[model samples]
Target: MVDIAKVTTELLLEETKTSGHSPLKFICNDGYLYYCKYLVDFDPNEINCLAYEIVSHYLLKVLNIPTPDIALVKISEGTLDKSKIIKNRRLCVNHICFGSKGIDPSEELTEFETCSSKRDYNRILNQEDVVKIALFDLWINNVDRGRFINPGFNYNLLTVRSGNKRKILAFDHAFVFGGVEQIGVFNSKMPFINQDKFHDSDFYKSFISYMDEEEIIKIVENFIPLLKISHKEVIDAAIYQLPDIWKLTPNLANRIQEYLFCEERIEKVKTVILNSKSIY
Candidate 1:
């Protein structure tokens, strides 16, 4: 279980151009820099974005995928400059917000637009995790990661370098479950499947060009057993962590739980990966 802690923002640094919820960077009382997403004032729909982010963060943890550490950051009054209109909306003050620990000496996958270098892949110590991240994206119906949809190719990935190696940390999941705007349309009967476009993107292909089909298959096949285990506790814990003040619909939370843990859906995803020749 994630020990979600509450911390206060100490100082505002800068607002990032990260797509959708353009989170601002701030130094928290924990003494760590975080990319914080604020609950926009007067926008109830913004709750969906924060809910998706927290749920996805826990789901990734259940899958053992690496991601930034999370916290519930309290944005005190006067924390934001009145002149700044951030996230295309007024920032909420004296409210709890979502925060992801900042990674320094790191670069986003977007930085390497279309890397075709084996050296780049070699630098990533956990390259096999690319396969896991691809599957996770499909399960969540994430549209923001690798595809150039309406938001336009927001990779939402960060890589940290340590000496000669690096590790990939997948972040920014506000657009998952068919996106924050489409929350009203989601239901238990709705299919949550999407083509694992993260696997098809040029950046993804470049990383695995050296990996043979069997090796990729091993990485994928290994995940099915883990998926077979019931994640009820994780799902419930994630939903329960969301503050009531956020006002996310209970129905949407239930649908997300059903969509992610359905037995039939898991089988379908497994079959799609094995039959679609996605390992190539």
Candidate 2:
């Protein structure tokens, strides 16, 4: 199980601040930086969101996608005032922020800016070195309700520099399409064969070239254990803190289990991801 004690409001405050419409931050904790979103109180919707983020991150990691380090952590007692709570909620996804050294290659990187803006989109394209970030979103099903306009990118555009060179890093799997049932349909405007034109674009091709299928498979395999361990820890902590409130309903629990453990479905996803050359 993940150590819930490691996720505290004080730690969140110290490591980072809120961005977008939510009270979440890209902060650092326990040696890794994450994009943490805080919820003042818990609700079914919020719980689902938190669950999605954690599970999606795990799945993406398993799929060998370049996602950021992620986890769900609860704020300790009294860290936030009851009055300060936006909706009488508790629990949050403690997302680690990237580009702590401020070497992010995305031209649009900013402090405390919401990702759901056209201006931000323009900035992301300019600053983010990679041309295929949009493709990354499509690959992971990050689209929310078929509305691709607001696909989250704060964590996606992060880059690390090493000796006069910058490397592209991808993270943030919380918003993947399957997480929210409202947007899980595989609606491709074009068929698979014609998808090559989209993939051939300089931006798309370059990023695809950089990622080899075998490498991604290995990364995904390595991440499963880490995710399993983290989920057990988070769930155990949740049960301890709010036993009655956080207990997963039998149906919800089954859904979560299926999402996490169904190997055949995951393998199919892998096959699609590996064989598809187009981003659409």
Candidate 3:
């Protein structure tokens, strides 16, 4: 859990652009770049996707996976101008947002797909990071990376080569627990929720190929304890990260509570972890 209150940075809207609910790059008052996400408009589900981004970012950090540094940021009308608006509304101005510190600009970074296509394993360094991310995705039921529709193109995987050290990083986690597009189906935890997508898609299959049974079980051992977090804790963590002005009706907050922190939700996460046996 990214349970701590983050240092707030005002969005420098001039350098930012329109983006969806997922993490996007923005310049802030500190003269630094951050990959951030926020709740700008009202969605039917009332689930703030930024909650998942912050949660997963910290979780990955727990496993020693190098994720971006996460924080709570602020945006205001004074800082946000016309360029930052999406759908005719300002993007989270006067609201708290979720953000991850940008990877140092001087580091030599490349997207995973492009690097993989170029056989840049020398730069990718550790294959185990790949295993950790794959198993973590299974545990969280993240569909973003290895989607059936977009095979071989993993979003949010970056390879950084800095001086003599090489590393792999996992960034986006907004789709964990299948929270974004198909909340009900993923929340239900039906057996093999996207069976065809994970099985038939080359993207997910490639992740499986990198794993051995030993690593999968090791991750399972570490992952379950984190789920022991209570409903109140999860709700509080998410709420603490949001701006006051960002809308949060009781109904939506309640639904988010049920979907993320309830006992049933924990059980569903366990179910996904158990099913991951087939992944290796």
Candidate 4:
């Protein structure tokens, strides 16, 4: 798990003025703005949103993936107008929360398509990054990487471009671990070793063609730190970081942390993703 920084939202900057599920935008006293994934939702009885975000952020960092800086912030009551947040993900009156560093609007970040269509998708994604993303998604069972086809998807594959230079800072993992639709099945969700649907996942299917076992191993080796950290330590950190409101139990944290750092499960995920590619 990452050493998640803590902050107090000094100002609520911009919010999801649209109809989709987007993070709340705000500025901290440090003058750095952040887009926080709130830790306040437990109503749908589906996802442990805060735990999911914290774990996903930590894993991505360990894997050397490019992502915005992450931190936990305490939002005092009345600091933010709860109405501004998207429906169902309302802000808490007084809560310790977690989220990622925000990207400034002036940065001109843009979104792109992510699909199997060769004509419009080929030039937009980097093969190496794409493969890494595939491996990561397969391991995490992330479901919302490219929900671009849906209307008002808000953010999809957000990217940055600057005069012949480009980069992608990844964020938004709300759908990890089967997400809301499959939340009922999280009790049995074993993504690391499960192959039934990973081969068909957009994050895996679109990029597996460019990958082989050797490349997959290299990516896994690059992320060795993920295994280096003890699972117990991860669970402990998660427990310590999350506020009491979310009610994420240690057992549930253990449930989520299981197999994430297991070597055997990692290899299984790699095998499934590699086997997805036809050798013809």
| TM-scores of the candidates in the order shown | 0.89, 0.47, 0.67, 0.72
Candidate 2 lDDT score at position 134: 38
Which of the predicted structures, 2 or 4, would earn the higher TM-score when compared with the native? 4
Q: List pairs with backbone clashes in candidate 4.
A: none
Q: Give each model's whole-structure lDDT.
A: 0.74, 0.38, 0.55, 0.59
lDDT of 4: 0.59
Q: What lDDT score is found at residue 125 in candidate 3?
A: 71
Please list the residue runs of candidate 4 whose C-alpha ends up more than 4 Å from where it truly belongs after superposition: 17-20, 39-47, 82-89, 105-127, 147-156, 181-231, 261-264, 276-280
117-193: candidate 4 lDDT, tens digit per residue: 55433444444555566567767777655444343222334455544545555676767777666553564335343
> What is the Cα-based lDDT of residue 89 in candidate 3?
49
Candidate 4 residue 220 Cα shift, in angstroms, is: 5.7
Per-candidate count of clashing residue pairs (backbone under 3 Å):
0, 26, 1, 0
* Candidate 3, 1-280: lDDT as tens digits: 5464455455544333423454446677666777666654567343446666766665576667777676776664665555644542435455666777777643422222333332443445765566556555655567766553433443556656776657767776766666566543444334435443233345334444445667766765675566555444555565665555545434444444455444564555556544654743
Q: After best superposition, candidate 1 residue 37: deviation in angstroms?
A: 1.0
Better of 1 and 4 by lDDT: 1
lDDT (0-100) at residue 2 of candidate 2?
Answer: 30
